[model samples]
Target: MPVSRRTFLGGGLAAAAVAVTGTPLLAGCASDKKNSAAVNAAVKLPTYQKYGAIKPDLPGNDAVLDAFLKYPANPVKAITDKPGDGQPISFITNIPGAIPPAADNNQFWQAVNERLGSELQISMASNDEYPDKLATRIAGGDLPDIINIPPTTVQIPGLLKAKAMDLTEQLSGDGVLKYPFLANIPTVYWKGCVFNGAIYGVPVPRGMSRTTLPLYRADLLAAKGIKDPAPKNFEEFLALAQEMTAAKENKWAWTKPPLPYIRQMIGLPNQWKEEGGKFTSFYEAEGSSEALEAGRKMVEAGVVNPDTFSAKASARKQWFNGGIASFDIDSFVAWNQYYADNTAGDAFSVNMLDVPGFDGGQGKPWMGSALNNVTAFSKDSKHSVETLLKIANWMAAPFGTEEYLFRKYGLEGRHYTLNGTDPTPTKTGVVETGIGLQYISDSALALYWAGKPDVPQRQHAIQEKIADRLVYDASYGLYSETLSKDGARLTKQMTDLENEIMSGNKPVSDWAPAVKNWLSSGGEKIRGELQQAFTATSGK
Candidate 1:
């Protein structure tokens, strides 16, 4: 369950203060390791004395609201004639599809360049390769003026040490706050952008996407005479899977991917700590053990196909074509892509199921974090504060506004026509009228929950239902460099172990020593570092 912000802060404040100020405190603490308790007691005294109550400054802005109401024209001038005369500002984005067409370059770039009063250039890279490329560029002292760092790779320690330009002061200031769209962002997300009390990035608000719910074939459930097919607990869920399999009369109960279902099973976030300072894999969490056991039981019972994990996209194809009965899928896939793929008729009727809670374990239901992505400025950018501010303002603007939609979707009549109120494309007019790949980073373009008529309203409905049912994993912070590099490796190892055990190739008895080894080898260190960091910054 989600803890209140106040409760989280109250519990963690001291540890957080220590982590944030630990560099100076480390010297003192280092000398008294022999008397650690005494040192801890001594440290508390000074922390309490020096650190007074720190309240977050919540600034209000009527001007920003006005600007939101009336979005002003682009303030910068076009650099069409002398393309390279002005300060050339480069924007590095992970959205592989965001790049505008070369033919429309003169029109689009001219508009962008004019809006920024700078020679604007846009570049695209794949999300998978972005972190490595970004790291190399930053390390080599080569950086674009505006660089986007997905929350997944925004390593707090590395970014701070690298001297990334701090935008916290600017963003919080009166000038930037005056842009109304900026206020639309939730303050909870600001935590990811804050490192050591300094902000280095302008958060690009991403709406809820990629969250998973039980995407089951409702028609199959009804045919099986199962009412209230949605399971509320792990046991019930497993039973439902069994029932569905039996009702299939030979068809598989569920499709499977290589991805483990434990994270969803126990409502635990993707990461957690066990014994040592090293970060243990989520699979190593107590909840995951229960989840694994559940899976083992299901497999042993023949509720799930032994070949389920080997099933691919073709499995989903078969399921939609009436081969398999039910499976788990993201709400978006079940509604938008699946339905659209079978335009001849409804391939399957679907419904969302609330992720089941563990019976004896944690009561939390697994859900995705609210944040989707973030945008940051390069540490070496020479652009003035005013220019950067303007860029940020432009970024915060909503879709369907003059700035983003017109550039992204093109002129409505000429490029595409609204098939109906729905945002997702339905007809060739909107389909052929290219929107490019702007959806990569643009939240407004990806309408996950907010509804439109022509599009799959079921997807939106399912998302909202899931949101209402599950709590966000507030314990897990955005992924940092240290976490990602280490966590990725650990996750892979753990997943391998799981595969071995689940396939009956290895026994669950091996889990203890394997866990000990994991912790002894750097898992504990990572955990301590993260716990320490979380405590220090969270003001708990």
Candidate 2:
């Protein structure tokens, strides 16, 4: 699991990722399923146009982000003209941290308002509280001009169709080319923004290049004089864990049993496997039994942190920071926290194993769906769709641009200080710019850090190594009523059972019957629904 400025901090990461669609909290609230099903309807999605005003050191490919080892010495404005009328514009979004200083007191917010030539009014809720707020707003028809739709929020494409702008006419195919910055978003990611048969919103993009992985403390390994050979297979990884565990010195090898990583290494399907338009859940896949057995073995090896057996991510991070644990799984986007928090100034290094296959073959690294959320234009607002879109375009200017730099670093001398080319955030900037502003309309997630050039450099190297072997969760952007209604509950059921089996509370053989239970209880229905979506969209 990962936590950071860009990534939501407190949530169930694995289950959320696997769900791909949404949660069940809003099951009691009904909307027209016909609208959600419109995702199956075919239309031209947004086309791709990589921003080239400032070239990146590590160019992006397919799912990889254009990686910048350092910020441009002098950034040019990506958009010169004002995108919107100077009228007040309101946005409702979820925040990863506390609300920033209000517009009256915040210089950063004031500067952004000046740039956009509008009073950018913002309303925020905590990530956990956002769903209820969104649902309430949608039901009451009180949406702001711009609404940030959380990826895991229950899909209400029909409701959105009623309350939000159907952007197909303005954004579909080359229509989005009119907004070059929005066009800069990779094409494949546009599927997430389309709901039913309409482009309901513009996506807030994440990336697969620097995805979630099992990262280890290379500094700790070097301190112990241990060489990192980048494990060839499961066997080698287990051996390395065994060698790294030093219980006598309050150190452990693993933060938790890497079940998902193991399942991926064994060549299991990512959430679902599709063949000839038929879909099968990963629990029923051929190698699932072996993956579970391996997970159990890894847990029983006495190398895992005991605290990690329970859901204690915050506690596990403590162990990692205190050197009580060597390996912890997290996103590369979230990895900067280590260096940012370090006082030792040793540039505490980290590295990953490249996730070798269970049998010493190529391992498939899981690719993220690349959508954080979609920011929709609310019909309730007085602003015109074109006007809102222009404002969004201004907000979404790509990295290395002056607009991007200003939004990110605020006034450099006050909000941030430069460390070489890096605009390191000061305490004021942390309280101001780092607030939930990106939830409005951010450029696709790029690879860059304030002062740590090697961090992104290493991330790019890892992405290149796994480039050919990346496996994406195909369930994303697909219509599934059963999944939308009871997905969180169902995923939690299977995850709980998997944890039980891994912790030895339930025998590994129990997996067979448990999986059978899953199929009869919505899994089959969800599979059928996904199959229909796949067929409708893919024309298989």
Task: Report the backbone clash tally of model 1.
Answer: 22
Worst 10 residues of 1 by lDDT: 43-52
Which tens-of-lDDT digit does each residue in 349-463 have in candidate 2? Answer: 7776687889887888776546677788887778888889898888888889888888888998989888888888888987888556677777877778767788788877888
Per-residue alpha-carbon lDDT of model 1 for 59-106, expressed as tens digits? Answer: 112100111111123412211232223687777666432333542443
lDDT of 2 at 171: 88
Local error of candidate 1 at residue 307 (angstroms): 6.1
For candidate 1, report its TM-score. 0.67
Q: RMSD of candidate 2 to the true fold?
A: 4.8
Please report how far candidate 1 places residue 332 from its true position, in Å.
Answer: 5.7
Instruction: At residue 49, give the lDDT of candidate 2.
Output: 82
Candidate 2, TM-score vs. the true structure? 0.90
Clashing pairs in 2: 38-196, 39-196
Query: Top TM-score: which candidate number?
Result: 2
